[model samples]
Target: MRNVLEAKNINKYFKKPVLFHVLKDISFEIKRGEFASIMGKSGSGKSTLLYILSTMDTDYKGDLYLNEEHVTGKPSVELSQLRNKHIGFVFQFHYLLLEFSVLENVMLPAKKLAQLSHEEIEHNAMQKLKMLHIDHLAKKRANRISGGEKQRVAIARALINNPSILMGDEPTGNLDSYNAKNVFDIFKQLKEEAGLSLLVVTHDEDFASKTDRIIQMEDGHIIHR
Candidate 1:
């Protein structure tokens, strides 16, 4: 498979009264259509690493390449465009707008990109929701859905823009065991069906073990793969 994302000698530091290095010389590469998981204990910089890779936090030292384009140090506007066009993110909590229905929430990203007309957006949103088996909840308010359903809606929203890569930060953290398993299964199915690269940070070893590759982090560094 071709490389979709690559990071070399990545380092992240947090400074307040004192400086704390959260990631130390991290290097990794993810290929197209690959499913990989980052496993770590709390405070191990798992989410921090994902944020850096997702371009949500760029105050770090390293080289990052997405689809073979150098992404480090890009202007905020350019970075936002890149993220909007090529990347999708799923967080532990479903960050859907409580005021909108499932369909509207799924259409949010495409709306921001302004690349689709009203009909196109609605059609695409429904398609994604259907793909995730959540189309039946299209008219339900985001806040009214169950946790698993909410996560599914978030997944649908993430995929509505057809991003080439999906970054997940403990997506199943708030789910029960059954729901977590279902979410993982959905992720696997989406990775196969969409042909998109997946990089997930998961505390659940069982879930991580199901992925194609497992990256273990400790002391803010990748210790195993």
Candidate 2:
């Protein structure tokens, strides 16, 4: 299988009151179609690592590669373009536009990419909503929905651009056990059917164990893979 992301000797530091090393020589590879989780305590720097992987944080001392392209230290504009094309993000809080209808929120990324016409973008947005079993809520205002529904809608929006890798930062954190499982099942399907790589930063052990692999971290270092 092909590797979708690779990190080599990644190191991140902070210099405020005192110099500190947040990440130390972190390295890992995620293969295509894999559903993997990064697990650690609150101070373990898991979120920091995920942020760097998202291509939005490039101040670390290491090499980062996505889709076999060396993306370390790339310019902001290039990283922005790369992120739009190859990455999709879901946060603990589903950051949907409350005033907009669910369909509109999902279509925003596709519209920004502008690779498709209005009609095509609409169709693809609906397709993603249906795939997540949220098509029935497509026309409803985002704020009118429940938390679980909002998170599902966020996932749908993330998929609208057909990103190669689907990333989640505590995607199920806001949902109850039932709804959390519901969202995770859809994630598994996305990995299985579309061959998309999934990298999730989460604290739920039950959820993490079900994924293909769990990369455990402690004290800013990977403890297990």
Candidate 3:
């Protein structure tokens, strides 16, 4: 299979009062359709590495490739476009617009991308919702759903754009044990049915172990992969 993402000798530093290295020459490749998790304790720089991979933090020193295309140091405008087209993100908090209906929230990104008409956007959004088994709640306000349901809605929204890679930071961090497993099952289902590559940062051992590979980081370096 082809590689979906590659990082080469990535290094990051932060300076508030003094220079501090946060990432130490991190490198890895994630194949297309593979599900992987990055695990590390607090201050291990896993989240910082994630931010770099997501193209949200470009201050690092290294090269990043997505589908063999070099994306490191790209302008923010171009990165923004790339993110909308190829990268989908899920967070611990659903971050859904409480005032908007489920369907609207899912359709929002695709609408901004404008690759499809209103009719097509709605159709695609509904299909994603159904795939997540939340179509019945499409008309409900985002705030009306339970925590598990809201997380599912967030996943549907993330998939609405058909991103090649899905990145999650503490995706299950906010859910209870049962709901965390539920989210993991949904992630697995999505990978099986949609062939999407996943990179998730999670502390739950059960959830991380279920992924195809585990990348463990410590003190700004990958200790295991």
Candidate 4:
């Protein structure tokens, strides 16, 4: 299978109070259509590694690639563009614009991309909502929805641009077991039905165990893969 994301010899340092190495020669790859989870205790550098892989943290030393294209050291504007086009993100918080309608929140990314017309973007937004079984909530104000609904809407927004990989930072962290399972099922469906690659950072042992692979980290190094 082709790699959707790869990191090679990644090293990160923090120069605050004292110079500290946060990541040490981290390297891994997520293949197309694979579902992988990163598991670690606090300070393990799992989140830090993810940020670097997501192309948002560029201060680390190493090589990073997305869809076989080298992305390290690229200009911010170009990296932003690549992120919009290739990656989908879900975080612990929904971060939706509460005042806007659900449809509008999902449409925002595509609108910023501007590669599609208004009508086309709107149509795609609805399709994503429907796929996530949240179509009925499309016209509701984002703040009016329940927590699970809000997270599903966030997932819809993430899928707006048809990203090649979906990255999550404790996406199920804020949910109850039932809702977390719902989110996990949705992710499984996306992997099986949509053939999307997934990389999730999770604390839930049950959540991590169900993924295809679990990458365990400790003290800024990968202990198991």
Candidate 5:
């Protein structure tokens, strides 16, 4: 199978405040339909690596490919388009607009994408919510839902674009164990059932252990995979 994401010889430096190296000689690939996690302690640079992989941090030195297309050095506008089309993101916080309805929040990404008609976007958003079992909360205000429900809404929003890869940064860091497991199971189902690729940075050992592969990091370097 083709790789969904690949990084070759990635190196990053924080030029300010003493010019420190934050990531060193990192290289990895996440294949289509695979589920993986990055695990490390604070200051380990796992989240930094994830940001690069997500195409949001373009200051690093290396080659990055998404779905076999070389993306390194692409113009920011082009990268934004590519990211919107192929990458889904779920962060530690839901970051939902509190006043919007859940359906509107879920539809926001697709609206920004603007590749589909209004009817189609709404239909797709509802489909995603239904898939996540959060359709019942669609008309409710985003802030009115429980934390777990809010996260589920976020997942639905991420999937609305049918992205080639889903990326998460400490996605469960703010959730309880039950909600964390729920998120994990949702990710697993998305992999097994929908054939989606996922790369998540997490500190939870149990969460890391359950994924198909764990890329362990230490002091800006990948120590294991």
Candidate 6:
């Protein structure tokens, strides 16, 4: 399979009173339509790696290739556009707007794309929400839903633009075992149904095992896979 994303010799450092290196020469490749996991303990730099891959943070040393295009040191505006069009993110928190209805939250990214009419965006949002089994909550305020529903809404929002890659940071961290399992199942379904490329950061061994491949991180470095 062709690679959808690749990282070469990635190194990230944080500077304060002193310098702290968070990632040291990290590298990996994700194939199109593959489900993969990055597993690590707290402070292992998994989130940082995901942010770099998603173009959320670019002040790092390395090369990133997305869909065969080199993406290091690109202007923020360009990076933002690329991210919006090709990448989707799901954080540990749902990060939904409490004031917005579930459908509205899902429509937010489509609105930014500026390619779809309002009606078209709404129709697409409803379809994605239905795919996640959250269509019944589309009219409800995000804050009024259960944690599981909120996370599913977030997933729907992420898929609104039909991104080529889905990057998740501890997506099930806040849920109970049952809900976490459900969320993982949803990811599995996404891979099977949509052929979505997924790279999830996780601490759970069982959850990581569910993916096609697993990369293990330790102290800001990829130790093994």
lDDT of 1 by residue, 1-225 (tens): 788999999999999769999899999999999999999899998999999999989999999999989999999999998998899999999999999999999998999988879899999999888888889999999888888899999998888889989999999999999999998998899788878899999999999999999999999999997
**CA RMSD (A), model 2:** 0.8
| Candidate 3 lDDT over residue span 1-225, tens digit each | 898999999999998678999999999999999999999999999889999999999999999998889999889999988888899999999999999999999999999898899999999999999888889999999989899999988998888889999999999999999999999998898789889999999999999998999999999999999
TM-score of each predicted structure versus truth? 0.98, 0.98, 0.98, 0.99, 0.99, 0.97
Query: What's the lDDT for all of these models?
Result: 0.92, 0.94, 0.93, 0.96, 0.96, 0.92
Cα RMSD (angstroms) for every candidate in the order listed: 0.9, 0.8, 0.8, 0.5, 0.5, 1.0
Task: Indicate the worst ten consecutive residues by lDDT in candidate 1.
Answer: 187-196
lDDT of 5 by residue, 1-225 (tens): 899999999999999888999999999999999999999889999989999999999999999999999999999999998998899999999999999999999999889989999999999999999999989999999989999999999999999999999999999999999999999999999999999999999999999899999999999999998
Residue 144 in candidate 6 has what lDDT?
Answer: 94
In model 2, the Cα lDDT at residue 99 comes to 100
Q: How many residue pairs clash in each candidate?
A: 0, 0, 0, 0, 0, 0
- Residue pairs clashing in model 1 are none
lDDT of 1 at 177: 97
Clashing pairs in 2: none
Model 4 per-residue lDDT at 69 = 94
| lDDT tens digits, residue span 1-225, model 2 | 888999999999988879999999999999999999999999999999999999989989999999989999889998998898899999999999999999999999988888899999999999999998889999999999999999999998998888889999999998999999998899999888899999999999999999999999999999998
- Candidate 3's C-alpha runs over 4 A off are none
lDDT of 3 at 19: 97
| lDDT accuracy of residue 62 in candidate 6 | 91
